[model samples]
Target: MDLHFGDSEPTDEERAAVDALLGPPESAWEGADRSEEDLRWARGGRAARDRRELLLPGLHAINDRIGWISAGALGYLCRRLTVPPAEAYGVATFYAMFSVAPRPATVLHVCTDLACTAAGADALCAGIEARLGPGSGVGVERSPCLGLCERAPAALAIRAGDPVRTAVSAPATAQAAVLAASAPDSAPEEPPAQRAVPQAGDPSLILLRRVGVVDPASLDDYRAHGGYTALRRAFALGPAGVIREVSDSGLVGRGGAAFPTGRKWQATASQPDRPHHLVCNADESEPGTFKDRVIMEGDPYALVEAMTIAGYAIGAHRGLIYLRGEYPRALQRLEHAIAQARARGLLGDDVLGQGYAFDIEIRRGAGAYICGEETALFNSIEGYRGEPRSKPPFPVEKGLFGRPTVENNVETLVNVLPILTQGAEAYAAIGTEHSTGPKLFCVSGSVARPGVYEVPFGVTLGELLALAGVRPGLRAVLLGGAAGGFVRPDETDIPLTFEGTRRAGTTLGSGVVMAFDGTVPLPRLLLRIAEFFRDESCGQCVPCRVGTVRQQEALQRIVERTGAAAAADIALLREVGRALRDASICGLGQTAWNAVESAVDRLGAYE
Candidate 1:
């Protein structure tokens, strides 16, 4: 636990993990054995400081190799990056995935979030724990949503070794989960990405048209299906023209904020600041939201192509994807797609031989939902705790190492492809006058067909649910995930758009549409949501830190009470909720109470 040098030396395996990420340290000062030259000069320290951002990746390297980060390994990594030991420890402990203490080499993450809970995750967890009890040489950790809501009760197994191996078991049973945890390399292969897309072959699809039709690994297949056509058009249009086309399309962000994508791009491009940056927020951590994961796994090239176009439009030559660490399949697919693009000159300097330079790098988020926020994502990538910075100096003005940065989610970036290829006028006409282009909705929980469904923005909620075959006796629908609100089943006629949802006093937050039938317990669901907020709060500010905990406590107190009996606690909830929404710094706190409040008022859970 000591944060001082020489307190504990890294073991051979730990040292190898750090060295593999940063390459061998050049001098004795940089974690090498003490030597005469280390006393004369601290030359390597300056070089190490320049690469401080690699600190997170370095921690991943060690954790992936050993399954847990040891104090010795963390100290060694800090020395290599010239980071203070305490600061490095803070970053290491900030994420849920990383473990600083010793544990089993293999760990199984069982999803217990909303969708999974509805599908009997409670029983699955109990069974798995009984099977993998102490001394089983495998660890069982209950996790939040694994972004596999379609196939609920999902389990992800990670076995650390020379090459860390991962296996996924969705709709998981105790036996299968234990098998995956015990022998990850021998676990069954996951279902293809297309399986998550119920409307795979539909020609009406725009954002997901090529998802299942083309081979994700083959660049030729992607191009034949209209892959880099957008980039080609972007090159012809030039940066300004590309921005103009996007602006004309009326495209807004798909990530909850619903900001105009064109304005963000224009602001970043117009910034007098040198070397603007583009960031793709691929950390799809919003519970019950997996549309972005489907796109990355099924059609990764589209995201790569879109990022290139976005970077070009924003006067940026470099783009970064802050992908969540748990998406092993999506991660593998994207890494392969990027390598193929680089090999074919679709990426790197002189992209498409258009004399324009652009490239991308992926940074894995350990396990932090707050990192989905633009500013927090930048901090996580910059080797700090993922915490949101105040606005005013927004991302477009000062972001990503204090430079003009344009940040968009995967779904938002991919929308640009249709805008450029089909022309802004055509794309704008598909949806309502305000909410343009197609939207992907993640439908799960008590639905016959649970998957990512692509529909035009203004489709009624009832229509969307009908496509998914909503179960009989539906009670309520959760539009958006834990952060969104609840609506009675009778209110399904609400239009599914940013403006429409706003008018209805709800939000189309990240296009999450979870259903619940009469058999499901609304009280437990609300309590679970409160627990999620409490667990995920970054604790940087007092309103969120205390408010989330207080909210969960209040909900827990009222879970068994009803009507007037619950009135006192319900009143307490509203006061805490208002404080969180009003005084919190970031969206996480601002929206923490949204679902709970809606459940109380709309569904009347207490009464």
Candidate 2:
């Protein structure tokens, strides 16, 4: 049975809602040199040629600027670009990021790419939704691509604010100064409630804010407001002191396993090796999480500096950023930032004249979620299909072409520069015991304000839901992604700390929170998840490949025919869930049963 469903045609009300979200398509705020002809070309026309070339680019540009492209706006774009409205709609729908429906206050994008889905993106979406309420102020969106594919299942948070206007100028076009008679020197102020904390006020806060914390142009302002001070401080302290400070800070890995970073560094540093390596795991494939993308786009230097510090700490002379090929912009920015750092002598040999040599190179992955796993990532770096390798001699002992290596997620490395600069105890003071510092939770789906939120570990799910602005009468919560467990609405009261989630029979796998209201059918949701697993499974293991297929067929049977034997099917589902959990080879096959288990626990009667 085909599980892919077509979207319902937008209703009149939906069209109006979409229009309201996207302001007037033609604005005086646009560049003066831009002509009506340019607008016409951008809007698209009926001609096939005009529709493909003229209209699609314009729609993409509009979506990039507005965070969402509306149907009404598509009509306007068709007129401007000389393309048909239907063609524009087709292009918009082709990309998962564009939304025809009215946007909520914030957009929480969960990466549903293969890697993230396998990592537990589904559970994260479900958990956040259950806590917040479905389709609340936050609109949780699933993105097919965010370019951070190596960082599989990444997510991003875009909040609704005043439109950001930019001038479009061609290379040959003369610069025209068209000043409005009453144009304010400063941009119009956002309402007090909408304005988030200033991204530039504190250095540590700036790191958190850099995760889509603010605008790109504002990055120079961040640099001016003491962005690289931490790096400078690290240079002063030398590598050993930097390692000591990070160790004291108690910062652990933001990747699935919460291992202490400083200890990992110490291991590499103590190793008497010629070319020890530091690698930034930009393969954030865990679903319902996109915090790394924000950091990469908003503040590339923070990661650069953090990696530099790691290079110093581990006595490594070179570093490699295993960035996903999907994140083209991020790769570009990182490449630019690396050049800038090298020019400033912050990278390269004798950085800042301290005689400490370190440099970084970017290695792009060809869209694999399992590559997020260190061993698999290493294989990909060596030109192989991304797949996990058996552990014993972990990445630290034997990684990256058999060299002693330290691999860490972008967020974990981003925290390093700050912790090294600020004392360790200061960093440890933010979150609960064991899990120190603020965690960036990519909360999406059915919430009032779905976005990337930084909360100290140990905050209750209820509190996070409140922050997310979930609506009333939440039905269920799917913690983690497909790999996570499910909790009913009553469990929202549980604390969201790692320990707390563990106590509730769920691991805080990748910190993705998704909530859902009663509008979503639980059985249908499980079936969708089952189908995804069956399609994406690498088929290396019997439990994952066959089990997922079996589960999908069984669920289909139940959904198709409801009878007295439905209970028997549900029991069979429970048994399959347990088997997959126990017998699977890798995380993909292993945690594939999370959604099924959760579904059976909460809404088994529907099966």
**TM-score of every model?**
0.98, 0.67
Clash numbers, per candidate? 0, 62
For all candidates in order, the CA lDDT equals: 0.92, 0.64
Residues 280-375 of candidate 2 have per-residue lDDT tens digits of: 999775655567766786678888878887887787888888886456457667888888878877789888788888899887653455667787
Cα displacement (Å) at residue 90, model 2: 32
TM-score for model 1?
Answer: 0.98
Which residue ranges in model 2 land beyond 4 Å of their true spot? 1-206, 210-220, 602-607
Among the numbered candidates, top TM-score falls to: 1
